[model samples]
Target chain A: MTASTAGTRLAIDASDLVKTYKGGVQAVRGVNLRIPAGTVFGLLGPNGAGKSTLVRMLTTLSAPTGGSASVAGFDIVRQQKQVRRAIGCVAQNSGVDVQATGRENLLLQGRVYGMRGVELNRRADELLLRFGLAEVGNRFVKTYSGGMKRKLDVALGLMHSPQVLFLDEPTTGLDPEARSEMWEQIRELAWDQGLTILLTTHYLEEADQLARNLAIVDQGRIVVEGTPDELKAQLNGDAVSLELAAGSDADTAKSIALEQGGVLSEIGVDGLTLRGRSADGAGAVPALLAALEAADIHVASVTVARPSLDDVYMRYTGRSFNAAEQAAAHAAKEEKK
Target chain B: MSALADTWYMTGRAFRAFLRQPMYVAFTLIQPMIWLLLFGQLFKSVTQLPGFGASNYETYLVPSIVVMSGFFGAGWGGMAILDDLTRGVLDRFLVSPVNRASLILGRLIVQVLSIVIQAIIILLFGAAVGASYHHLVMGVLVLMVATNLLATAIGALSYGLALLVRREESIIAASNFVLMPLQFMSTGFMALVLMPHWMQDITKFNPVNWTLVAGRGALGADPDWGPIFENLGYLAVLMVLCAWVSTRAFRSYQRSM
Candidate 1:
């Protein structure tokens, strides 16, 4: 990776990076990533999947226990100041000083990166205008709404015109409307500014919508890496969902569905709804219905759709994203007991 | 920009935030006035005792109370740092290429500024109540500088404790634990000769006593030049040591991250 020519150096490159905390908790375990210059990359995962820890290491806020990485072609460990100067990071928590005005915060951040006088003032104003915060730029952040505070956080990160911008869960706590607005701002930051962006998100839709290239992280490891469409295409099948009647037997229905010729895997049942994949959903529906009828299991309704990123996750992890999250939470609870 | 410039810029941010809280500043400033008025009158008769050097209680109480204000204000300075740590503002600065010393120093500078303002207010209030300085303007400036040094040193230690514990409750407990004992042991509220023999000996080592003695010499009828300069030097050395400890605590925090 280091042998790349000057013109095409990777914006961010990590090889076998690991981070084990003081109490033996391995937050990030040997994860590797290569993000191209001037592209948007996503790190997608559930709540406890180490996405935030990986960002911390990349941003130079925390040190990795093993291996090495570089940002903008500078070694993260040895040239940390250079790495910091080349990148901007908007962390998961809002980092804006609530008592200070937004413009003051930006000015201070710009100064921290060595900007001063006219250059700093101009950049701070430009960012406020760019993020649609110019009207309230001089008002104290304590008076701003949640969405406005988050916007100020992003604006502060961009105060130095960094080459690589890292947004960790940029829209995690926002409402639906604010989330879409934040998505627009992120897109403009990457597309118009030509900045390389490495975003971490737990929302699959956000990853699919904003990231051109993404890696699905689970349990401190990368489970899958590709463009969202490419990942979805890897599951070369249609998703077939069957809604069973209230008194229907789910085990018998699953066994019946498995007996059909085109059924790809075990049925996934969420309460009365059972789902499976098929090579050709339309053609397999008749045989699937006949098998269920033979077993005298009643089905209320049936529908088929193209495979989504959710299906892609299921195909790789053998469980849905929500189920995996719940199981992880339950296991953690039982461990505490 | 140079490191000094970065520290100044960061200090401006903290100073602006402090200005926004008018009510907080008002309360802190007013509390010292209440102590000076209430305690000065309550102990006015102490000046009539033999071996007391001052002609009036207000003259003697003014300088001590001014030093007390600085001590009290600087003691709780870490609450602001705790707020920054919880809100992620400190981490934002940590990720930047800014000088790490600036982060700690910038905060202490703000506390020193507040202490200076409080000292000035006390000075004005004392003059209104018939307290006159020994050397007038020059002596007033010395008192201000001495108070600033003491506040900066104590504020630095408060920030160090803030980073070490990172819990509001524990920081407050640690602050009171150190402050209450120091207040009882120091010569801030009384003259050295008035204290018991053992306490007078122990007060020789109290950092707060160094601040008070310097302040009293500046405002007394006849200023003692030697002990004032010596104690001011001690305050300067203590300020450097406290700033170093605060920076070390910051390093530990980054490593733990």
Candidate 2:
């Protein structure tokens, strides 16, 4: 990480970044990230994983409790304004002022960056058109739909042509359609425009689909870091899912499947579904099916998958992502009281 | 240059939001008139007393109303900052290359502008009710500046309170607690000479009364620029002090984040 070089490849270079809130809640313990320029790096985690806290420190919204980090090679603490100038941050919470028109927000954001007159207007217009906000650009943001308001938030962040972009759960509250639309926009942003983007998302599908490289964050630390495919490949085998008949006993089905297994890792069973792992999945299925059939266990269907991000999470964290999220959510509620 | 530009742009953002609620503007201008018209008439004979200085009470009440209007109006300034803080807009601006001063200045600009406009209206309403000043227009001008200085000071303090507490009920309760006593303690509602000796001593230190004295002093036939400027200087000092306290609150905000 060359602080003086104008052409440093690491758009974001962080080391041992930590954030402990005043009440001693160590939201972010010790996390390090080095994302190359023009790559979409993702931080995937559940609630209370300190994803938001880390983003806050990196974006210069919060002071780090310890350690150091830099964006665009400028120290986050010392060169905050430079880091702020080099990066555009779209926080988990939408920062749009609902009272102001979409265009008005853009103009103000552009002006804050020292843009003026016609050039500013042209950039604002271009972003409005690009984000499909041109139709509702003159309307107050309160009137805009969730997707439109979110698009405007991105537009506000992009007004100054920042070198790096931080999108923290950018599609968190959008409906499926809007979420996919945002995905396409993010894809375009990464593929065509080539900006270094650091996105934090709890949605496995979101991280899998968009991020070129990602880190799995849990309990304030990076559990694993690699490309999505690399993480799933670490699972190394087939994820066999058995949809048992509606009336079939889940407990009985689990034991029957476990009986005829080699190199099988028991993944959990939910209601009428039983899932497990096998290195020789295609070959092992028939015998396993015959054994269940002999026991009068009626099988509805069986399918095999090449490990998902969830499976990778389960393997590393020793718990499913949803369970971790639920436990964290419960703890958060207790802490709030 | 960019820092000043950012502050100007921030003011524009707050002003746009201020305009969204026409009801706010209505209440801001009209509420003070209720005090001017009704309270001025109710105490119509107060000017007959020695040391009241004016020919009638309404004329005396006009400058006081201008002072009170800005005082109360500026007290709610924290609510807007709290709204922005909760809405994530404050973090948006904070993470940008925006001058930190812009956040305070942005809201202050709107507060001052609102008080200035409303102060002019209050002065005119006083005139309509037979409250004539010796130098009518110039007097109103001085009152506007004085009132705005007071408003900016209060607005900065409100913003500081918001950043510190980050709670609505706390800001509202704090505003009421601070404003109610300060409102009556000053010469805003009573002639200074008629006030209790102890209360008059408090008035000497009260920024609100300083604003009143400055505005009222300018309206007299023989305007004393010396005392008026002195009061303005007091208001300026108060503004700077409040601004310092408010900016210090930002450090707390940053650390808490």
Candidate 3:
């Protein structure tokens, strides 16, 4: 298949990639992806959607069972050294040495990447300051907080000034505040350094905030691929939600909403609630209120908002974001067994 | 750059970590000291046996203890690999431009250096207890080379196994399983002539026995250069073979990952 070349030069290119575990379980099945330079490309997936597996292949950690991948213009298998030289990987698990001082860890990473003498020390100090880790650079990593360790992991990955950076779930277990800080750092790296970033995340808000373009992956394949705005625009309307009194007849409320030029999206049985999408939720609300009044349905509350990435994901996958995440976690556990 | 300079830089890191925990240093030396104190006295009268070469048991037993200590120390060398794997330090190195073989070689070199230091300490303790080297200077140099080679081979083998098993418990179990039998089967405790004919035949295949023979030749009153070279040759072959196998195991580990 002809790969897409719409943006800048490709930093990562994979075609028909496949990876199978030891017990004949296919972790990644015939996936293809292209990431352009100087853009943040988010790979959004439920836990076992082969996002990590794909990252591993692209980073040259593992060879694909079939098909091929190239990172920074080097074949992942045949030219693995060059691939490794060009790409930095902050893996899903924080790969920091807890016993070593944060500065020592970065220095060792620089040495391993062939940086030497004055240049290595200078770069290590630079990264420490850039990542706000200069104060803790001399402290052993075991004393570091979770966020600090994660920042160190990222710093280690970037010691060589790699062309492409693969951050696999950069904020998986962080608190809300830490997660936001991580997002901001990621954005700064992409914007300030012009580094091509491929980030994998299950958080819809994170993807929407950080990615210029994203691919929604599920069951080891790309389900949909587009910019976050483009994907949200696919819904093509504003979202309206209504909460009615108990026993107020949700069917009647949905019918009322449909008659008011809004498409009935969903209805909740317990609260007798209705949700819909429309070009103009404000204009549709009065007509819907009139219909509900004629039907004697007591509307307790109503809300209208722009279509969020959550709604877009639910619309495309027919599953709530949380439910999809739970399912993905379950699949990953089963695969591990 | 000189290879020694490269090896020293790598070895220095290991030594720094070793110095951080005095308890580990104490633990490493305690085992060899036990053999020196207890086993040396127990076999004090055994040196009266003909062709034993050494007039005193302490003199004979010290060299054996050094070789034994080196082997025992080498068995635990894989702990560094296991620790690195658990901490993701190995993966960090794998993703970099460093020489892949150097990663393993550097660690093994550090292990050998550490074992050599332990050997020197044991030798000094033996000298204090009235044990003397046969060809003083040559004996010291040969003992260092032989013990380092033996320890390096075992250490590299353990490292390769660490990559295969990828668990501390399993690596310890496998190292113990290999080490205990070799320690007993070799001439570490008793001379070859004192053992059964069957055991004597078996010692020919044991690398530990070769180390003991080489070390013993250096410490005896009448040093036999021929048997020393022969024993050194055996250990040299074992080192090459084990290193080759370990490299293969390392390659398999990378493939599996």
Candidate 4:
């Protein structure tokens, strides 16, 4: 929580930020952050893990039930207006007006920040063009593809050119191409304009690819925080993942590998899959594969790779990443309905 | 920009969105006119009954119909707010430097505009039927102002309810629950004299009845300015009070989040 970030000018600084909602639901539990200016920081988590809640507090959309936070050096509680003016927020949910044209949404957003007439129109046109939405600027947003709508959401956030941009789950529902495009825009915003971006995403690749530093949030708390490379490097060895064909006995593979495959160690078998870490992945692969095949295990696919964010998540949370995600997805489904 | 300027801009957004959704606007405007026309025609002969206020049912119902149109139109104000809430448009504005008052005022203006449009059409339909306006400009002017004030109150209350409920179905159910009974209890359909004694007592406390009394007073050839101003004054105060409550409801919404 006290780790010093890289720069003197911290864009967002919070100490022990806590937001406990009604009925004893602690949505955010004492999270601290120091995000330097001109960089991207990611809050990576599954659904219902309080990433959005934390972002909401930082954006001044919801007051912290307990702790304090300041955005752009203005206290969020005492100086909400300044905090609001200093930050541009794009929530997990798309905020574009479906009935209005893309250009219209941007212009209104500009006026919301007190920008007027010529300046507002110029900013709107610039955002539309920069986001590749210039051609369809006049069309209703409802008709736009999911990716296009998402780009407009990001464009709308940048309309007023605030000091920091907060993006919550920016790539959640976007198609692959659109997600890549949004990534490009985000990268450009940080590198080109020297804008500070606080992005929240569940996608591991999103954090690894874009974030200068990231934190994994689960059950209303930050489990781990560091650069993606640093977090993955915390573990000492390469990650080994293998899936078995249907009806193959995972126990037979695990016992056979431990007994015969001397090179492979610390192996874990879960249902039809075996996951473990290896000191020497290249050296262990041949022995592990031979032992599993000799034991009549139908090895579906074997992968030896670098440690990923998901592995870091598993190491810290003691639960499979996808399992947490499936549960969060279910809760989110029930919530919206 | 000032909150007032922001409100103006926000109002433009709401107004444009209302116009853009042609189908929804068409239906909202049309439903009340059908009620006015049918109520006028179906109950044309009811005016002959004892203690009926006017020579024809249409003329007597015209002023009440104007209030009814405004009330009904204002009820849908919640739906508009709910659309923005569920769609995250409200959150976008909340997280920005946008004024909290502007968020409420902007939509209130749009809701009043929507109700007033319907009020004008209902008035014209009334004139087309048996209803007559000797001082057309004066009569329409009073009703327009009255409609704006009353609709503002109704719209504010609708927005408060929408914030409290946060569900579209609840808004619809709550609007119907509060509105249907209130409309029937007011002097919208029948003369107060024709109603049961108990119902008449309730009508005195009804905001809709207060509006009806004001509208009908202004509609007369020899209009009574004092009583009309009195009711309009009450409605203006109610508008202020309701707007305050609705604005405070934003706190409740944020608390829920």
Task: Report the number of the highest-DockQ candidate.
Answer: 2
- Residue pairs in candidate 2 whose N, alpha carbon or C atoms collide under 3 angstroms: none
Estimated TM-score per prediction?
A: 0.90, 0.91, 0.92, 0.90
Identify the runs in model 4 with alpha carbons over 4 angstroms from their true place. A1-8, A240-276, A283-303, A332-337, B135-138
Candidate 3 lDDT over residue span A31-103, tens digit each = 8889888899999987877898888888887879999988777889998877887889898887887867899
What are the per-residue Cα lDDT tens digits for candidate 1 across B145-249?
888898888888888889889999988898888876787688665667888999989888888888888878887777888999999999999989998898888
Return the TM-score for candidate 1, rounded to 2 decimals.
0.90
- Candidate 3's TM-score on the B chain: 0.91
Show where candidate 1 strays beyond 4 Å. A1-8, A117-119, A244-260, A263-275, A286-299, A314-320, A323-337
> Which of 1 and 4 is ahead in DockQ?
1
Local accuracy by lDDT, each model: 0.86, 0.88, 0.81, 0.85
Between candidates 3 and 4, the DockQ winner: 4
DockQ of each: 0.82, 0.86, 0.55, 0.75
Give the per-residue lDDT digits (tens) of candidate 3, residues B1-257: 33444344455556666666788888777777878999888878777878655577777788788888888888988888888777777777677656667777777766776787888888888888887777878888888788878988998888888888888898778877888889889877676788889999999988888887787777667778998999898888888998998999878877776
Q: lDDT for model 2, please.
A: 0.88
Ranking by DockQ: 2, 1, 4, 3
Error of 1 at A275 (Å): 4.5
Question: What C-alpha lDDT, on a 0 to 100 scale, does residue A77 get in candidate 4?
Answer: 92
DockQ of 1: 0.82
Sorted by TM-score, highest first, which candidate order results?
A: 3, 2, 1, 4
Kindly list the per-residue Cα lDDT of model 4 for residues A1-337, writing each as its tens digit.
1112222488888889898877888889999999988889999988889999999988888888887877777888998887787888888899999989999999889888888889989899999899999999999999999999999999988998888899999999888888898899899998999889999999999999999999999999999999998998888579787899999888878888777545566788887888777877877888878777877787889899988888899999988789999998898899889
Runs off by more than 4 Å, candidate 2? A1-5, A241-275, A290-303, B48-54, B222-227
